[model samples]
Target chain A: MTPNLLVFRVLRNPKVTISLSLADWDLLLRQARCSNLLARIHSLLNEQGLIDRVPPKPREHLQWTHVIAERQIKAVHWEVTMIRKALAKVGPIILLKGAAYVMAKLPPAQGRLFSDIDIMVPKDNLNEVEAALMLHGWGTTHHDTYDQRYYRRWMHELPPMRHIKRSSVIDVHHAILPETAAIHPSPDKLRSSACSLDGYDDLKILAPADMVLHSAAHLFNESELDNGLRDLVDIDSLLRHFSNLPSFWVVLVERAKDLELTRALFYSLRYTTLILHTTIPPSTMVAIEIGRPNQLTLTIMDKLFTRALMPDHPSCSDWLTNTAKRVLYVRGNWLRMPPLLLARHLFHKAFISPKPE
Target chain B: MNISTLTLSELGHRLKKAGMFLQTGTFITHLKTSIPSVAEGIRLLYADYPLVEHLDFADFHVSLTYPRNLRRWLKPQIQFLFDGKPPFKPLPADQAFPMLEWGLNWCVSSHANHYLIIHAAVIEKGGYAAVLPAPPGSGKSTLCAALVNRGWRLLSDELALIHIGDGRIVPLPRPISLKNQSIDIIQSYEPDAVISRKISDTMKGTVAHMKPPANSIIRANETAHAGWVIFPKYQSSVPAQLKKLSRSRAFIRIADNAFNYSLLGIKGFETLTGLVDASQCYDFTYSSLENAIETFSALEPPASSK
Candidate 1:
């Protein structure tokens, strides 16, 4: 593996929160003189915008990201073709996340890095939409009883499902986030939030705020972070890209407030900025008012939040591990919950929620 | 050399002994192949059957195969194809159950195509197949197995390849898996249904495989149009219900069902949406498979466009 890729992989580990320890800092500073891989990797991340805290060398990571971008664009193109094929008959719908940005003329490979395909449809049409896929030959990945209940009952979308014949997995959703009923934005409104690609008038996409709002919603809702490093990076990239758009802040807060997700919006943006070192301005920071999450809301999120019930995060702290949770706090009615539900959810999550096993 | 004859529990032991699948998700050890794209072939051909016992009734099965010798690489992948647990924890002791291990091994590296085959249950009647795709307890295999015992042509008890380029559903007929309660339900439903020995305490409760309908096995090479795509939720006492679906909505729902929709892009959308447009869609909740069969048999296929 390329040195940068090796670093990328290691850094992507969910276990390595953005908390760069003293050793990590030491490792970075000393990487330049070590070996060709480290030097090359060091050179690349520098170019793509690595921190200067270590030492200065010609930037090279951008080239790496650029190379990955080239390959990723082609892959995204193929993914778009698959999505188009899947949706053309259903309706002129927008492809969300990775492919949508690429299709919108963002860097093909560099603009996005997506492992799974995510798409949204009108809520009313979930069944017909799912039926169409089944008839075509995709299989739903197994979910345990609690998760199944979570998706079918309180949640807005089903868990990620796979096809019987192919090797890829696709995640279908009618809403940007599940179970967080706070953002009950009308699907029609959300659909209207999309704009068609430059040439593809027939196809549509999520509006800028919709995309940003969705990203924040994800961070708050379940982005267990264990899924992969790319997921966190996706959220980061979108936040960076979306910032350039005028009036983005207005739309973000409006949607969040409407969804009762202001606090979530606050936490997501704050943590993303803190971790990714994304460039955000004082004006926008003041507008979203980072931190300042409602005490009640944050508590419920931290307490009720069992990583076991989460989708998956790139984070290695372990879903059941409380290391991260200790950093946050809660209050009132939820303060005292029994431990039994935790085991039950964890058990079901590991065993029951997935397909029969 | 063959492991198909052993019980699923035995196969579990063999898999554990084999140990450590290096590849993640499904294992694909690439080698020289004259075939243009074996992956595509498995996606379109390869009939399959998955025997994991963790789901509800009514799921489907399909498989993908390749030449063997890559067995080491193929071992860990067997569980993934059926949405089996990742090697995240100790694979349960009965993980040695032979039918699933051998069946999956046979399907993935069988000189057939490039898939790590999955064993599952599927149903079709009148020309259209309703791929009952789900992880075990979604009541897929049990339901598909039961339907086959009744009269629904078993397209596959395993993998059903749907060429992303063209959404034709390939019938990969194979043995159906009947797990836990459904094994008896099928026998009671169809007195003469043939079933294998039930091995209890396996990873997925008790498990068994039903022989594929003889005709389905013969027609395995044929492909069928997917007329319906439904996610069936079976509650012990929930009455059978069918709800009509829309083309736009079907697009998103089915997209979630796809294993490689993202990889195929426009083709995936076209294949999926085409199937939706051509088929009548439903969200079915059922308590009785017989009633489901009766209701399904009576519905009118979407009026073919003039």
Candidate 2:
């Protein structure tokens, strides 16, 4: 294997420890991100002191590659705290992706790397909770109140917002799919089948079956290359984590049927498997996809999605432009919402999109 | 074939050797399998973790089951957990993380529970805890990891437990994460800090863990009164800044950020309301970790007398 490929191979092994010089790992990170994302990463490394500190115990203190993992653990811890605090207060929050995996208490960064937390809440509590957040230090960054109202009214989720104190942006979503999806379920029905985390008083989230479908929907619904391997990672982790329960697959298919999200799920499975080289069982994979997806559609989406994940992906702009036109065409059919309503929803997202500052 | 994309059972078979079962709330995680080989992927990933004993469960079978698909990535983990096993090939750290993460999720979420779990980052200092709840790129984790290194106690880099009865912050102190460049910044700050092995190509950028401070671990279950309700953001080259937030906005933010806020309905509302009311709210922004440390440490915690 090439040197880079060697690193990839070493990473592929769960047991192999190819420890690099701690400083070497730090240098590689600089090359790993775009200027914008890299700046933020460097600050975090400086703060966590990963650049300065070598591994302490275990006699492998010099390996900075392993030390690089401190960032992953930090992210998991941050995501988990959000889930726990919510669970502690109102009820158990339905955790998704990285947060859920991390809270289960594995090595902090060993789970998935999620970009933003996607959480669902009881629909009735949406506004009440939004109000509650406004009162705390998290403020609405967007100024248009109508846009905010549009989100609460039409979309399943609110626009993201920035924290007044912390400036952290957050997406307070009430639903998973937007009203625009060509094939989708009503928010009300999705909420009905949602599962409640038992540790809480009355908190709940989209059911596991629904969650998987939603994951698929998120992957297939949009222009497809916004977030990188994350959405796929979510699907991969969700399927594996829930696979032990024989009923999970069966329920997933059924839920997809009910929600009309099967097509997306099918495409997602077909493409993720082909491109990322995901290893779903042939039986389960077939069941998940029914007949195989069109090779062309799968390839296009897969290539686009793959590019989105790579920070230094060479053709990002061209890919994104092409993806945008396709995305709009898809959006036109999926969403039957009026232009006015769509306008309102978009407005809500701009203002309500979660922000920490 | 890349083992990461494999299914959970496949991984179980490949890495099956030794393990244990960990159950909490609606989650059930089996660790330390009899085969011992399965533990290889995760053992090294979590090698530094302090094991705890629970006398409550003797009835269930204890076996290790990771997201079977993740066995290949978890090879290093096996060596971390198994001391006497023959030397095995270890995968890159990040590749193994997903399988370990998948296994942990099954363990925690599968266990029966009474709390509505969420995904977030929590940190406490001087009896005042700040909960940073966000999705990727919100800079919540980056800031939380930084805070813990500087004097603020790491309640948890990921999950925080709020007492259902009184809305107090419960500690689940664990490692802080730094991704890509952030990993180096943290090491330079405290070279002696215990960080986990690095794993690249995760959902987030290259990921790493900052061993949570010892004090946070010793007081893992300690409760701290909600002091200032401040959310943090790390914008490069941005000077440190803080500002007040409105009540209505705070309500929305907290409710949105909360995992189970609405699950508790009136109770959740009351608890959240009380938290915001008792704590002075602010939105803080900074680019420098040093400034962040100085900024937080300089803040006067909510008056204890109040």
Candidate 3:
């Protein structure tokens, strides 16, 4: 059993014996902390009636984290209400990712922690939506011209707007993937398939399969690995919970192919099953495996992702992990743009301000 | 066995390798560091803390280490890692001990939500605890150091961990951090106090920590109910005076000084209200530590304590 597997196994079956040494528990907690899934782990333990079995001291800490997550979820609901009121005049706004999971009361929302709210609107309505949000005290974060132009011209989302009063950030996206990316998911199709949330007339949640595909796209296409493992866990929970529905897997595969996200779905299923032991139907696996990377690429991806998916903690990491993350970071940029554009972006990013001061 | 049982060298060896699990009050922290000042800080300050056995679980696993790069030779710095993640950038190596103290406070304030933690100083006398909730540079730690030396048991110098359900103050009797001029003021007030060496030119401007009373460390597990909720302010050359503060005002002041009040939401509100209900509220201003200590000692004890 690899080190990363321990946290997943214990989370999967919370009734497993609590026999780890203090040092081992420290490592597990560190890994969970890095992934931002400590509260989720605790909630799972509580669900399985194993929270009490955890030693008294560590239990107190986990309980504290659980309380914080509860408050955060309440804050998310309040933010959603505020957004709903602001965007009431606009057409239906579809919630995406963590916000959608929470609004829809999915299993992944249980003790989930998130920092931003993502919503999708029609591309033609983007101007009206941005203006409405601005009037309602949400303004775009102050970015220089280059950043503003970059986001406006190429990205699927507007420069993220933050609330002046509440300070919660909202990402207003017209589609799932960036327009400049090789694959463009149809926003109109996604909006048409979105289901209206109960009691929230203006708010809609993505169809279940779209939610999973979007999560996968966001995780696999992004350069940042700080939340890589947590996002994968989100994918795992989404799959496990939705798999309970009849023909969910069948629809999920069909939807992936229709949406041009088969590549992302292929990686998501591979890693979720490999790392989390997520139960994917064998037939569904065979259907999706058509988009799997070639053997040489698969071997390289396995090396990079296996290390990258673990929380960047000392107890679960070694020398190769950082190297793997850096290699993947460059790869993410390469995948996002053509070679000439990618080179210019990298140079501009490197010599200019590396980070927002 | 507690950390005091280990020799300085043994403690250093353990810190360099796996870690030394030090149990304080309600949490166990597995701390690893090879820096000499950090080792010395643990030897001098945490000597009385209980050492958790190998099988027990720790609430936080932290490390203080030097950055591995050419920058280490240029300026030299230390970093605080919680579960191998750096929350803040590295500070100069000389600030390591103080950084450890700050890091421990960060761990509790940022993560410990089971309690309604306020940025306050708490000290106990008889059977009641006086919670001094104040913002930085308020001289709360100076008063706390003075009171504890004069027989008030130090509950905590930085955080008043109020139990959410019961509204009792959980004792986390760590060292009293005195910043800037308060470092010299504390030394002059308690000439015999066991204060660590002052680290000059910190972000807070020359900070030093006074050793908690040995009795407080020995009785770390003992918690006390809130009896007086005092907001202390220190002004130069002014005489010490304590005045009765309105309950509503006290509530607002505590909520303002709380680290996780908003994060805990309504539970934080109820806990603060319960605390104010159970204790007499006061606004205290003092320039003289002697006068301040005498006033706190003369306060009427809570009805339950009597």
What are the Cα lDDT values of the candidates? 0.52, 0.53, 0.86
Writing each residue's lDDT as its tens digit, candidate 1 over B1-306 gives: 112333444443433343111110122221111222222222122213222222211111222222233553544322322211132322332333333333353433222222212233456777777765555587777778777766778776556456444666666564566678888888787777666667687656787666666667556556667677666778878778888767687667666655445544455566666777777777778998878888777766555532
The alpha-carbon lDDT assigned to residue A320 of candidate 2 equals: 64
Q: What lDDT is obtained when candidate 2 is compared to the true structure? A: 0.53
For residues B1-306, write the lDDT of model 2, one tens digit per residue.
222343556445434543333322212233444333334443432333344333222212233222334654544232222111112233343354443443343332222112323355777777787766565566777778777767787776555455555777766554466678877777786787666666777656677766566656556657787777666767879888888888678667767766555445455567777777777777888888778778778777778546
lDDT of 2 at A24: 39
* Best prediction by DockQ: 3
- Judge the docking of candidate 2 as incorrect, acceptable, medium or high: incorrect
TM-score per prediction, in order, is 0.42, 0.42, 0.95
B1-306, model 3: which lDDT tens digit per residue?
Answer: 667888899889988998887777777788999998888888888877776656446787789999887889899999999877789999999999999999999998988888999999999988789999998888899999999999999899999999999988999989889898888888887799888998999999999888888889889889998899999999988888888899998999899999899988889999999999999999899988889988987988878555
lDDT of 2 by residue, A192-301 (tens): 77665545444454666776777777666664444433455457556656777677777877778778777777866665554334566666676866534578966664
- Locate the minimum summed-lDDT window of 10 residues in model 2 chain A: A1-10
Best by lDDT: 3
Give candidate 1 regions above 4 Å deviation: A1-72, A105-113, A143-150, A179-183, A227-232, A294-322, A325-357, B1-306
Tens digit of per-residue lDDT, candidate 1, span A18-97: 34554343333222112112323433344455434432111222232333344457866776676666666688766777
If you assessed candidate 1 against the hidden native complex, which CAPRI class would it receive? incorrect
